[model samples]
Target: MNAEIDFAPLLPLEWLAVLAAISAAAVVLSLVLRSPGWALRGLAALALLTALGNPSLTQELRDPLPDVAIVVIDESASNAIDGRDAQTEAAETELAAALDALARDPDAPMEVRTVRVDRRSESVEDADQGTRLLTALEGAAAEIAPDRIAGAILVTDGQAHDPEVFSNFPAPVHVLLTGREGEWDRRLALQTAPAFGIVGEEVDVAFRVEALGDAPEEATRFARVEVRLDGEIHTVVDAPVGRTATLPIPIEHGGSNVVSLSVAMREGELTDRNNAAVFSVNGVRDRLRVLLVSGEPHPGERTWRNLLKADPSVDLVHFTILRPPTKQDGVPVFELSLISFPTRELFMQKIDEFDLIIFDRYRRRGVLPNAYIENVARYVRDGGAILIASGPAFAGVESLYRTPLRSVLPGRPTARIFEQGYRPEVTELGERHPVTAGLVHENAVQAAPSAEDADPGEGPTWGRWFRQIELEATSGQTVMSGASAAPLLILDRVGEGRVASLASDHAWLWSRGFEGGGPQAELLRRLAHWLMKEPELEEEALTAEVAGAEVTVTRRSVETTPGRLTAASPSGETLEAEFVEVGPGRWQATIRAEEPGLWTLTDGVLEGVAAVGPPAPKEFENPVSTGAVLAALADASNGGVMRLADGMPDLRRVRPGRTAAGRGWIGMARQEAYSVRDITLTPLAPGWLMLLLAAGLALGAWRIEGR
Candidate 1:
């Protein structure tokens, strides 16, 4: 309990002060005149003034409130290097013990609150913000009253990304750093890279091999960097360390083209995780140039034209055979209104300019001679794409199979035709192919036990084609079957090019909405893109998808038994990914990602790469720890940064403006905080007592004057 003098004024203080002044002057005048009762008069005046002032005594029942000392611990990725983790653990224990000892003090006690900031606690969205010790410190300080805060202590590697956040903090901030001197690391840093590029075009990428801290001379001179495109080793280049170098990488195909670069690890370096970097550049086509050759004006001819024209990215060049050279109609050449077909210009001069060539119901005609037909065959052999949409003429005497182009065609006509209507079915192989995968009718979806449980024999229930040309698939996989299980669609790879054959011309019926229609447009689009060598439409593929720390590995193949896939993590540890059949010819497995970096997966035949986080994790950007990051912050708060390697500092309490840190000890301010539990006010001068005192003093003065 504490007592202090307080006031409860009965009259205005100004008026009271004036009356006191007048009484003091009269007493001084009496003293000058040698009056006998001057002292008594002064005493009476004091009593009256005290009564008017209303003096009171206040007593407070108080409870001492403990000051708060916050300790923020750093456990980020960088803190785990070079024995820093153990150092941090030891420092944390020492600080906690010291704070506990201080809490036992009877006069000045403190409550210790520990806050931990680590990479694992950070969300995927905060992955870019490295170590945020200041953020955690602010949060802990906000939990208590500002006046009750003693100080903030951070036990970390001193690589705080947000160090300047606590300039005006309420109390001193001290840092106990981990890690020793002479630490070093070599890292691969991407200075500039494109997020996307045009397919088949060369894009310039700039990067640097960085040497941090006390890296050796060998690490700072020249380094061998391995560059990989789509998980396969593309090349090895000698890069000069500490300088940016530009490399030209060609975008192979459409879709994600991941380019990964990793430098050779140096001995005694901090970590190998920062020695590698991975980035994905999306490959996009400038424009899809398609050449559509129609043998005759058929009902399905306009369907292909309309579909290709609807896409803004496709540049379609169409031609129709109206008048062949063998036609015997006698007419003047000038009088004819037909535009001559530029067969030589399209088939011979500029055949390489087109990305895909579509022969819609086309057959061997006199307009395109045997020489032009042979040129088309040569075109397919040298990294070109051709799609054959056969009509009845394909099985007749004018069949394209009879020409030199038969060498590149995947199917051969059997001189037979099925005129009956039948629904097209996707073969078992098509279920795993990216183009035909996951395409099922609504009825098929409802009929299955579940969405993933597809019936083997079930196909899409849509409009039926009235006619199909019978063919023998000689050199390709049959993806679609027609009436009576006959090959309807065949896909094949000849040398570096691709070929696709669809043995029916009634696909336009579906576009006409006949019998509720079907996925004609979708099927055509996928088939076209697949023929153009789109990477996503490959027959066999290995890929990985990452969501947080979980990685899902998917293998797509036509074979029934796909062996176990081997995955190499960024840390160079190999893990086996077992497969379970999720659908026909498709298998999947999910595993927990051990760390964040580039992950390479291979199934002997195909390889793929997946990145679990950003191209370069910020935590590993500067692996060697030092006190430079938090030095300014500590100085601003009147604290010092000390290394735990020397020894744990002694904790002490000091005044607010004094130095909070010295060579051997760190100090926290003495807050002296308290709370008033209860307050009682008692009047010091009562009115009756004041009046009696005044009358006694006045009578004394009167008696003295009479004497």
Candidate 2:
């Protein structure tokens, strides 16, 4: 309870002041003239003024509120290293007991609030922002009023990624570090990783093995690092620690090329997770070098040229034998076409330079000898790609099957030609193949094949072709069929190369919008990419995708049933997972990934790697516990820093603006915050009492004046 004096004037203040001034002047004049009863007149005036000024005694009943103290605990991955978690829990328990003790204090009580910063408690949105200790502290303090916040205490490894610094805190902030002194850590850090690199070229990835804290001199001298390309060990390199080493990784094919680097784990280091880092660089072709050789001038020849030329990235070298050596032409040599075909330079000298070779209606026309055709077959075996777009000539005496190229050719000509119009259909195997899967929907055409010459059953959804060569698929898988299910498109792998056979010249009919054009552009693009050995277009593949903490493994294969997949986590724990068929040939299985590192997936044949969280989690970047990260914050709040290894410090209540921390002790501010529960006002001067006193003084003045 508290008491104070207050006033409520009965008359206006201006009128009361005027009456007091007149009475004071009259009393002074009487004193100056030596008149009697001057003192009594002054007393009478003072009494009258006191009656108008209503004075009261105000009393307030207040309830003392407890000062709030927030404790922010760091439960991030970094805090889990080297017994820091145990230290944190101990500190939390000790601090809670201390706060409870302060709550029993009669002078200044405390309300303890705890906020834990952890990845498990995070939503998918802020999961990437690791170890936000200060952010959590600020959020916890926001709920408490500024005056009621006695102070905040943080128990962590001091690896906060949040850039927030509190310049003005309501009270002191103390930091209790969890780890011991002289702890060391070794980490693999990626300095420079290009987002893209040209296929077939080497991209220099810069990285370094760093020694943090008090790492031993011998441990920092040299480090053995393993370089992994696409999840497989590519090479082992001996790199000097603390210096940037550039590793040249060759881009073998187009699409995503993942490069993972790992330094050998030290026995006593902070963690092995940060010793490995993984990043992906997309492999792109500088220019697709394609050699398009046409045996004769045909209407469909322009279709191939237009498609290849439309892409600005393709470097097309087209050659047509308008007048072969056998043709007796009467035209002069100077009157012929400007440039001569460099057959020897292309086939013998620079054949390996081209990424893809296309033979459009090409037959044995004596322009290319048997040796050149054999060289072409050898090129396919040496990681080259070939597309054979055969016409009716494929079934004639001059067929390419008769040449040395037949060794790599996926199909053999049957010496039969179908002249009737037929709609091309994706085979049952092609429905699962990446190249032809969902091609029907992408064509965006619902019209049936040409009704006049269509097959008796429900025709294909695309347009019709007038002619197709009948071929027996001796090797490879048939992806498309025509004319009563004869092999129309066959794809195969020869050595390290790829071969594709499209047995129809009437593909141009679809390009010309014949009978509602099919997916000519889309189909040809996919076909070319497949022939060039694009990773996404592989017939058999193992792949994994990550969404938050779940890893979805997808297996695409041409086999009837894809077997189970064995997943090896970053910790080398293998798990056998069965697959469920989601699509035609695609099977998938999802696993919860609690770890944040590379996950290796394989089915004994194909292998793949997927990253669950960041390849190198930010939490483990600086796993060595220290007080430097929170030093500024503590100093700004006039607090102190101490290691839990030393001992749990005694908690004390200190006055604001004084020393809040000292040797062996930390302090919380003494906030006298309170709320008023009840108020009472007792009138000190009543109107009747003041009137009676004034009348008695006036009578005394009259008696003195009469005497």
lDDT of each: 0.86, 0.86
**How many Å off is the CA of 74 in candidate 2?**
2.3
Misplaced by over 4 Å in model 2 are 6-55, 105-109, 120-128, 163-165, 444-459, 546-550, 564-566, 573-580, 591-594, 636-638, 655-658, 686-707
Error at 429, model 1, angstroms: 4.5
Q: Model 1: residues >4 Å from true position, as ranges? A: 10-45, 61-68, 93-111, 121-125, 146-148, 214-223, 240-242, 332-345, 427-433, 438-461, 547-552, 558-567, 574-594, 602-605, 675-680, 694-707
RMSD of each: 4.4, 4.0
Local error of candidate 1 at residue 439 (angstroms):
4.4
Estimate, for each residue in 290-345, the C-alpha lDDT of model 1 and write its tens digit.
99999888999998998899989899999877656677689765555456778899
Clashing pairs in 2: none
Q: Write the per-residue lDDT of candidate 2 for residues 293-333, one digit (tens) a residue.
A: 99889999999999999989899999987777777778875
Per-residue lDDT for 561 in model 2?
76
Please give the lDDT score at residue 630 for candidate 2: 83
Question: Which lDDT value does model 1 have at 464?
Answer: 83
lDDT of 1 at 511: 90
